[model samples]
Target: MKRLFLVLALLSAGIGFYSCTPEPHFDNVPVITFESISKNTKLDGFGNKTDSLVIAVKFQDGDGDLGVSSTLKEDSLLYKTTYNYQVRTFRQVKGAPVEISQTISNSGNFPRLRDDNKIGPIEGTLSRAILIYPGTVPKNDTLSFKIKIMDRARNVSNEISTTQVVVNQ
Candidate 1:
């Protein structure tokens, strides 16, 4: 009876560990969707705040191929994460709303790979924070954002846009 109890305990531990880890990826490309965006305003040395936007997203991949191949080389940094962003700032113009647009691709790895040789679907949430400097825009201006991600197969996820945010000075 003691031997049987020990076996069951070990089996339970193994299952718990497996469920917490990321599953292997199959051949299908990963899919990601926009979740939410919120601002983290902090005061600088001059007592002025530069907006830090936290972007949240949900992702699923049949073949867990969403991250870089390796983390040792310079090339790995380029393919690891495909966090892309497009921003538009709205100004209160005389007649129509004046707007400025900018596009950017983030660098570095997000560590979204399986640890074993198995192949299966993986799903999780990814969050990134970016600092936005309100250079020329006047106070009370508004801004919007569009974002997307890519998988190892170079499959681009559906683009998502954030709601209008007031430029807090």
Candidate 2:
């Protein structure tokens, strides 16, 4: 009778452990949420002072193909202009809204989250610093950014916009 009781206890413990394991369910297409945006002052490569807007975003991908290798060459599959992360800047001068031109390159690439070739779900926060020069915007002006990310499979994530931030303050 003791042997049968021990066996049943072990079986119940095993079932409990198995049921506690949680599996993540996410869409293959990437999804992103705006986390935060902050401003800082820093020196540029040219020894000039500049302001930086650090934008943080949380992302989730089912396949985890969210970034490109630094050594990978641009091809038809991944065009030169296909940046993994894209940021569009907008400014409001005294509450008047205006969209910045595309002449400024606010897009860049993020390192791959998973080094292995195997695909799986991934979720993390990505923070990027965008430099703002003296004339980037007027003093005491408010700025905001619209952000999106793309996976290696050319899957574009949902777009998210950051809250307004005062620059040159």
Candidate 3:
């Protein structure tokens, strides 16, 4: 009786696991928005020449295929740009902070990847901490940046920008 019960339980568990199917998490492209930004000095090798700037992004995906596999390409979903903080100004609208458009002469990518190369339906805020090296951005400087994400299907997310984030001393 014990053996039969154990066998039945194992079979049921296997069946349950195999029955689940992967479905599209989103109908179109993933949606992303800016959440917050913070400056931390410890992650920059604990040195004065550089610091780490942490950026938070909120995203939602229906299909959950928001990253490239290593077999296909080198880049992942995340990308970014940097700008001088003084280049743009912020406005107060009904006690809300509004971002002003700015043209940046220099821009680059801040690609991020997933460990497994494959992801399921996901909905949450993702945060990335990038090292602000001397050449990337000057220390003790203020800057703004924009970031976006793309899915494996080439669907891109809405771009979000930080009006200003100060690098730590």
TM-scores, in order shown?
A: 0.63, 0.82, 0.53
Model 3 whole-model lDDT (C-alpha atoms) = 0.58
Candidate 1 off by > 4 Å: 1-27, 75-109
Off by over 4 Å in 3: 1-26, 43-49, 73-121, 135-139
Model 2, C-alpha of 61: deviation from truth (Å): 0.4
Local accuracy by lDDT, each model: 0.63, 0.85, 0.58
* TM value for model 1: 0.63
Error of 3 at 104 (Å): 16
Which candidate do you rate higher for lDDT, 1 or 3? 1
> In candidate 1, which residue pairs clash?
25-63, 25-64, 26-62, 26-63
lDDT of 1: 0.63
Candidate 1 per-residue C-alpha lDDT over 22-107 given as tens digits, one digit per residue, 9 for 90 to 100 = 64554366666778888888887887877887878787878766664454354554443333222334444664456555354332
Ranking by lDDT: 2, 1, 3
Worst 10 residues of 1 by lDDT: 79-88
Clashing pairs in 2: none
